[model samples]
Target chain A: MSGVTGQGPRTDLLAAVEQVRALAAKHAEETDEAARFPVAVLDELRTTGLLGLLVPAEYGGLGGGLDELLDITMELGRADMSVAMIFSMHCQQVAGVVHHAGPRLAGELLPLVAAGRMYLASVTTEAGKGGHLLTATAGLTAEDDGLDIDRFAPIVTGGEYADGFLITMRSPEARSAGDVSLVYAHRDQLTITPSGDWNPLGMRASHSTALRLTGRIPEHQVVGEHGQFRTVVLNTFGPLAHLGWAASWLGTASGALSRVLRLLRSPDGRKGANLDSELLMTRLSRSRQRLETVHALMRHTAEVVTRVRAEGDDLSRPRYQMLINSLKITASEECHRAVEDLIDAVGLRHGYLKGSPTGLERALRDLRSAALNYSNDRLHLADGKLALLDAEVRFA
Target chain B: MDARFTELLTPYLPYLGDRELTADTPLREYGLDSMQAIELMLSVEDTYGVELPDEQLTEETFSTAGKLWDALSGQLGGQGSDTAPAADAV
Candidate 1:
């Protein structure tokens, strides 16, 4: 698909992203300090027509794909990780609707997104299920003409600001937790009450707070077939989420590295003993290598996803599952490690100070959340089980 | 009904200890999760030398021992044989 105005999608999207980046960069410090959402950045995204990024061109969107998603997210991550994460998550839900929504629902929602009038939020996390996206403790109740949903999400990132939500819940006739469905509801269709405050060590601008949601949705609003949300999770949501987050973390690490490089090239750095120390140079080099490794792996996984989608192949295959899960695990860990290495290379004053000109302090705190975002330990456990069945590792 | 099938599946279903592995037993009740189901599918394929097609990969197919056995039998029978290869022979 071409750009919104017939220009190249990549170029047009990146140009708009550059504008958002400047705004996010400008407000990132205050956003983090105040523990608030970056309203200005989001406004820029809407005005630039980037909110409709993943919707198809026929629906008045740019019709961009996974590759474009990675580029936009990486750029945003460089400016502010919270902005990057919010945008990435929005795209994840858009992809879900675009790929799995029934024709009528698609026709209804995609144009609003394409017109940059909507921002979608994810509602997968339940109170007790920590990072488990495939199952739900809340079950939909059958009503006269639709299903009644009363779910308490433990953490809904950007929930208050979202124009709509894609929620996961047990089907009305579900016999087990795995019998799940993905449902969509506009903000006006539901009563969303904030239940708790969100004050975190990092990524504070995301406003991931507990929320109580009550609503009624028609059966037609279900994204896929009843009790078949597993297919949607494994196919679209899983891969795109992992890739988008990995790219965001990669951009965060690279942003810190850029700060470090700037310091090294300054006249004061040249006059001081810092530039001459091989140890410092070596540490920076190691960080660079790690970041580069993450970038390469993330790009490769995105390409694989694009290829699989293009070929009409199933992405839930064990090999692809392993690949996607492994990317999240590796990128989260490596990006954090790269940031830590840079912190040590730059020394205590610049790296440890809260308001240091280097800005590594904020980057460090933001990148720290990467490992705990979805919890790498949980993913490793899942991958460990999958590794037993998928013994052969084929690389093409 | 096959001893090899029982042997291959038993390890993953420790929750089903000492119970007779019947055709109608609900696999999920015996702690068969999505990942475990996939692992079980792979083992069945490796042991029986038959690939379960993508169309057959569904929650219903792995909902019970009977359904899973039927899927495996279908694949094995499609290879022009009613009898599975001997457990001890392979």
Candidate 2:
């Protein structure tokens, strides 16, 4: 198939990331301190062509895959976790649009994303689902103009700033919550009632707030085929989001550690004649090893998901999903440990304040969101359930 | 139905229950959703080692066992001349 409307996968990823780092560094402090949207960072991302990095080149994008996205997100995460997260959410939405939607729909939306004129965000959470993403408490009704969707999403990441939002709802002909449908709507088509604030412990710049949305959008905005929401979510959106989340964690932790490494190499740290340079170096090396492991796992999982898409049915298996979920848990925990060790290498006494030499406090706070984003406790339960299934255990 | 087609498709049609599928039986009536349809199609392609053209993947191809058989046979160059448009569709 022809790639989306752009040049082939971007060859200048390094150059683009260098520009993004500058923007991220400029906005990281105030954006996090005020819990504001990283508008400047996003604008720079769009201007630098990094916004369409994951979009197919045929659609005027870079045509890069998960690996390229990971590289960009990790660099962004190193600079600013919030900006990395917002970009990841945008990419996940783009994947749903290009991969699952029919050709005509893809033609309409992908170009806009590819051109950096649009950003997609998903609204899948509901008030009564109790953290279950697969189920929806809302319903869609067929109207004369199109479909009328009125639902309350307790939390929509990037909702306020999104150009388009993909929604999950029970199908119009459904008898139960299991029959779900997904649709995309231009932000102007919906009335989004802000239900809550977004101030949080970490990743404060993501703009994840609760919203009540009521809208009527044209039929063409519906994503995938009707009644295929479960399959599409499992096949496309779920995998992208999971991998993107892991990459974000890896990136942010690495960025914070880089600061600590700088501190270790400074005159203050090395000037002490009796300082245990060997021990500090070893600690930093071990932390780097942990980040490397996280990177490898994320890379391997993305490759597996890509292969499954081409080969079919592999990603849908319960065992494969279990393994992917474990990667999220492992990456989150390992990333936290890496940041902590880097902080120790920087020494706790000097500049131990919030905005310290290494900014370890902020990194730790941001890393905390990884585990709580989907909750490791819930993921472990899912793995336990899969343990009893009769299935082939395979890997890439 | 071709014997190979029957053998490959039967394993995926547990939803058809006790009703034996003939070449005339519409596959969709047995509650085979898109995913299952794709699964059966892929299984046929894998078994016969013939890649079905993307344009041939539609509600029409798998509407009935006969149509699917025709599509597969045509691609495989088997020349099975039972080409009645099986119309109890998906």
Candidate 3:
């Protein structure tokens, strides 16, 4: 509860985020054009100790929660969505460890993470599973004192660069596909072979390439109880992942709108005849309206998650699940729409140019991935099913 | 077993076509996922007009038709006691 809304002064964390934002802005274009990871920005985050932003203070981290995550990711999204996304995904893994790991694992791992010595990546998506996170095709092989797993994930964001991975596999004593376990393995314990290219429409710097991984995971490293990875998914990964992604997308839209506003106020824009056009003003206003709504929803959802965690409420309950799902769906769709409207308002000559002062072109391309990253269509189906169960529809 | 309970669960268990649902039948085998389990819980609550306590909302309670019915009947008080095993049988 203490760090839920970032209660105390977090000037140090915010200041470090500002520094990361500057670094992201500097290398964003080059990173995108080269379709590579934002090395300089991530290096800056490591050196600044911002990598441990979510780790508990007792473990040497800032002990920030979802609120702080939203603030940092939003700022990063404004500068470079890829950087924001990478950071967001990393935080998701850290949250899993924080919330679900046993005492021994927590004692051993959190300190390393808090010390900014480890960067975690997620390996939930499998070769033929699409984006499914609940079930696993790969089963863990029981070793004398641990588990061995060979997993082939079609997309592992920043896989090669991560110091460790949170991998999901079928439980050793599995009854069905849904019986899954989340295992943590350091890079040294795994033979990770990068496969496929990472060239994408946008978010190019995310470097989300396919990876073939085979690793040995000690028993203590298996998160939560055996076959309770679903609990971890529902409680931590699902909510935080959606919240972080939505925040980044919201930031992208907001950054675009700000740039457009700056352009409209410039001398060139003041001299233009369209500046007086009511249509342009209306479009800008509409974009702002959408972005504002998304902003409000993102903050509200983050607060709910923080409160639920503090109060020991079931996050998997129908109402909470629906709220979290709606946040992702609405933020992705609305933020994309806002970016589109801003682009329309800026017009082709400036908006269409890659090097335009408005910077709307890059923002447009980046925001396009917001909907497709996890595929809004899949979420809609899941939410539709959840809706059948959430009979009351309470909003309090 | 209530006919309405089976009727309500049939749609969610597409894998259980042309098969009668027995009390001991494992719901997961017939494709009753976590979401469907919740839907089933709501449908059972609606049909029985009984509000299941938060403590009764658990994976074990919904693991099978019999267990689910046992929990529902417990909420319903004396009725269906013949069908449900003793509350502390496990």
Ranking of all predicted structures according to TM-score, beginning with the best and ending with the worst: 3, 1, 2
Cα lDDT tens digits, model 3, A13-44, are: 76788888999999998999999998888888
Candidate 2, which segments miss by more than 4 Å at Cα? A1-11, A272-282, A349-352, A390-392, B1-90
lDDT of 2: 0.76
Candidate 3 lDDT score at position A312: 81
Candidate maximizing TM-score = 3
lDDT of 1 at B1: 46
Residue pairs in candidate 3 whose N, alpha carbon or C atoms collide under 3 angstroms: none
Give the worst 10-residue stretch by lDDT in candidate 1 chain A: A1-10
Which candidate leads in lDDT? Answer: 1
How big is the positional error of residue B42 in model 2, measured in Å on the Cα after superposition? 27
Real interface contacts reproduced by model 1, as a fraction: 0.06
> Candidate 3: lDDT of A385?
71
> Could you give me the TM-score of model 1 versus the true structure?
0.88
Off by over 4 Å in 1: A1-9, B1-31, B38-77, B80-90
For model 2, residues A91-117, the per-residue Cα lDDT tens digits are 988888878887888888888887878
lDDT of each: 0.83, 0.76, 0.82
